[model samples]
Target: MGAMASRGFDHIDTWVFDLDNTLYPAHHDLWQQIDMRMKGYISALLGIAPEDAFVIQKDYYRRYGTSLRGLMIEHGIDADAFLDHVHDVDLSTLDQEPRLAQMIDALPGRKLVYTNGSERHARNVLARLGMEGQFDAVHDIVAGAFHPKPTAEAYQRFLASHEVNAGRAAMFEDLARNLEVPHELGMVTVLVTAPGEGEAVRESWELEGREARYVDHVTTDLTAFLEQLHLQR
Candidate 1:
């Protein structure tokens, strides 16, 4: 194994988890609502049909980190306003079916929430899912300078800000590319979401990652992943 790929699994003292689909299931159609809202925002801004706006919006999200980023750079829109619109999608759908509080309580060491969403959004989602008290730290997109996933620089920033020893840490993300730098940085990397879920959101299970590159392990469901965790040392 390469040097960066080895630090996470055995020697790490910390665990970093991605929020959004990694914590829940992407198949819940969470992105559908967000898509609708994004399309609405774009259509209102550019005077286009919602359908065409949606197509263009998807292109932006796929090309730039987020459609909001593209809008901010190209359309000169307010970042805060865009964030409010995109993240305001309905979250009432995230259920307690995964009941992860006990599993989190049973976790062995320091656990941190490293998400691309805003801190408030992360807090709300966690609260809605009954997992509000599980993590040691919460890092969000605003704090991270709007540079969310697949960016090695952001992960470096995350490590620097947290005073984390990357060599002694593990990171769990549903997005494959997000795990790349952590793996390269010697983190114990765990890919928490399954395949075929497209990468609509930052690291949503709906997206696909280049698993052959940096992924350490793969799990179809977070609940099942936690179940197997208890049996391990």
Candidate 2:
């Protein structure tokens, strides 16, 4: 069954997933809390009004791969300080969960986190989900590593460092653009759909002129998706 099933899919030996929206449901409104903190940081750093800073931060995040990266090149911003400032979120509102952890423990391949977020951000999310020990690897946004996702350069570097066989690895992410490179690289791509509270961000999921097929699968919830995947296909 393992051999035939493996062949049925694209020989999935490595499964890499995104951390943020892909790991937790949007209905939790965790991102909203985090966003406010990030905006606040931006305002304080640039000495601008909070509202104006939100626009500036988003603009830089869009124009460049990450706001910190843009800030690094343009303003000589301190990367560590920026990450510390932006990620200051209260996780007390979040409770530890074991639902997804079991599913991940059952998956039959090497698992890794390939995210543009820092290690601290990933750690917080994983711990909250009771999945702190699941992944075999976690990549962070630091020190000229890989270009970070949504860009070809970062994807290329990610695969290279992991020694990933694209034919055998699966890449899961919430961002459409980030998965596009993995799809083209022959990695199976899974898009985690927004559960709730993200209707306003729907347009952000679409990649312009992305025709035919780029995603192998899509799910509205992470743990639900993993539960199904664990079953015999």
Candidate 3:
């Protein structure tokens, strides 16, 4: 048992997974709660309607890697408060997926959760998925000093903190652009996303069309993907 072979993932010794949509399916609708909270926070901060705030929020997310970063830069808002408010969504929509847990357990190498969200949010999502303690670490936005994905510095800091060798690592994320830096850094990049999810929130920075050079693999079903690798291994 060595790996899927076709993907040439045999050399990957570090498996870094994104939380939220990557670890759990988009159908769970967990992101919707956070999305609502972000708009609410923005509306309150700017004294605008939720509808207007939503438009600005997404524009910020597109211009900046994260809406929080945009708020901090443009308005000098409190990052800690924004994080807490946006992540205060209910996790009732999420439930444990035993198959995913089993699949993650079978994978070889060190596993870690790398998210632009806060650790508290990651913990809630992981616990809801019954994946607590499975990952070696949860590197959140705070760990990256509030610099979110698609930002070179965040990736650099994460790799240094973990002492990770990018050449021997693989990153699984839902967004396409987030994988670009990883690919450039010599890490295999996998885009885990569905068409509906991609269309709903993916920004212009996300990979368009079929020429996904930065993405080494694409999978709609994370559990099945991992299972196939495990079987081949």
lDDT leader? 3
| lDDT tens digits, residue span 155-188, model 2 | 7777777888988888877776777788898887
- Give candidate 2's error at residue 30 in angstroms: 2.7
What's the lDDT for residue 90 in model 2? 68
Error in Å for residue 167 of model 1:
1.5
True-structure RMSD for candidate 3? 2.6
Could you give the candidate ranking by TM-score, starting with the highest? Answer: 3, 2, 1
When 1 and 2 are scored with TM-score, the better candidate is 2
lDDT of 3 by residue, 111-192 (tens): 9999999999999899999999689999999999998998889999999999999999999988888898999999988888
Candidate 1 per-residue C-alpha lDDT over 1-233 given as tens digits, one digit per residue, 9 for 90 to 100: 12223223445568788887778787766666767888999999999999999888877776666677677677888878877887896777888754566776667778889987778878888888888778888998777777766677788789888899988887877667678788898887777754564444443532556456677777776666666665554
Q: What are the Cα lDDT values of the candidates?
A: 0.74, 0.72, 0.86
Per-candidate count of clashing residue pairs (backbone under 3 Å) = 12, 1, 2
Q: List the residue pairs that clash in candidate 3.
A: 1-233, 2-233
Instruction: Score residue 129 of candidate 3 by CA lDDT.
Output: 90
